[model samples]
Target: MSASNRPAGSGRLLTGVAWATLLLGLWLWGRGITDGSGASSAPTTGDIAAVGRPHGVLLPAAHAPIKGTAPERIEIPSIGVRAPVVARGLDKAGGIDPPPFAKSQTVGWYGSGTRPGAAGAALLVGHVDTETKPAVFYGLSAARPGAKVRVVRTDGSVAEFTIDDVQVFTRKRFDARKAYGPRKDGRAELRLITCGGTFDRASHEYNANVVVSAYLTGEKPSAGKSA
Candidate 1:
């Protein structure tokens, strides 16, 4: 994705700090963000064209970044996703250890990375599906640009993000920096990631990843009501 994927004039750089950490994060993320169950199931990933906003869908102005806060839950009304958030770190293999398959409905935040509502891009990852059923982000690909994504934080504030871009990047074209970096400097951003593309039973993993990019556009003291 590029500036065209965001509202005009919203460009930013991936600071050295973000770049260096993302290098290691991407290493594991690109190898395959999540594992598969191998059993045949309906694919949940979307097409590559999912990138960029739909023609004429105007987006809202960016909201000033807020103080760092831990996310407690995530809600995407467009997709009917209301899931609890959990903090997860790198596994022994150096890859982000996502919420276990048994907890398919949970979302995992990169606890070591940027906190939600902060300047850097906060990353939340989840499984797309399992051998027998759909997972937390199963309908993520179906989410359209301009839709709202609300993150309930621990500080009694809710970080509201507007969907700006959604892309399905295959392993070959998965650029860690571009996929995970902030779209606008100094503006709070969020990246929702999950295994996408066709599930290769032989390898037991998906061929691509669904990356949903959003930027902070609103906030409230708590999840009092919908925006």
Candidate 2:
């Protein structure tokens, strides 16, 4: 969806805003989410109805999407998060795969979507906790506005994004369309996701998710690209 043309309930999960055209459809295909929650029931008829009427917007031409090098690492200093970024693809169920439990400190980039320095919203997902302890994004829900998220890419450049907002969405109200959609049109953006809130022992899942929204403010020089 266009950044300027967000559907109704725009700030929410479902114009499911700016991640990219294919994001809402493919990214949410969860492979048990890969940790243990298993597949989710399909959205209701209302949801199916709302998806058909998406919105759009136009922006100044300067913020065109730039193709970026594949990312290698991600760093969030305030939360003491620094980890390797592995390119993850869709699992059979269709959700973007997350970092495996064994590698608690790692983060996973949705390789099929926008690249770090690219024009559209790039997605990065990680675990909030594992069976025994907190995971790499454990403090994700605590992030406040203006926090910096740095992505080091293969071209030796660093994509720096500033956190615009950090929100927690409950499983019951999880709107995959809104959560994965873009907020601003024509600007490079990022969405960092992880589980949050209380863990539901009955379902073996986190009751909520922490979604941090950021935009490309600048970049570190590399591969002939100037700062």
lDDT (C-alpha, whole model) for all candidates: 0.72, 0.61
Where is model 1 more than 4 Å wrong at Cα? 1-51, 223-227
Tens digits of per-residue lDDT, candidate 1, 91-203, equal: 67565656755677899998988899999799998867655677888888888899999999987788999999887665544567667777778989999987666665554
For model 2, residues 112-206, the per-residue Cα lDDT tens digits are 88898787778888766555566787777666566788899898888888777666555555666555656777788888876554544454444
Top-scoring candidate (TM-score): 1
RMSD of each: 11.9, 12.6
Give the deviation of candidate 1 from the true structure as CA RMSD.
11.9
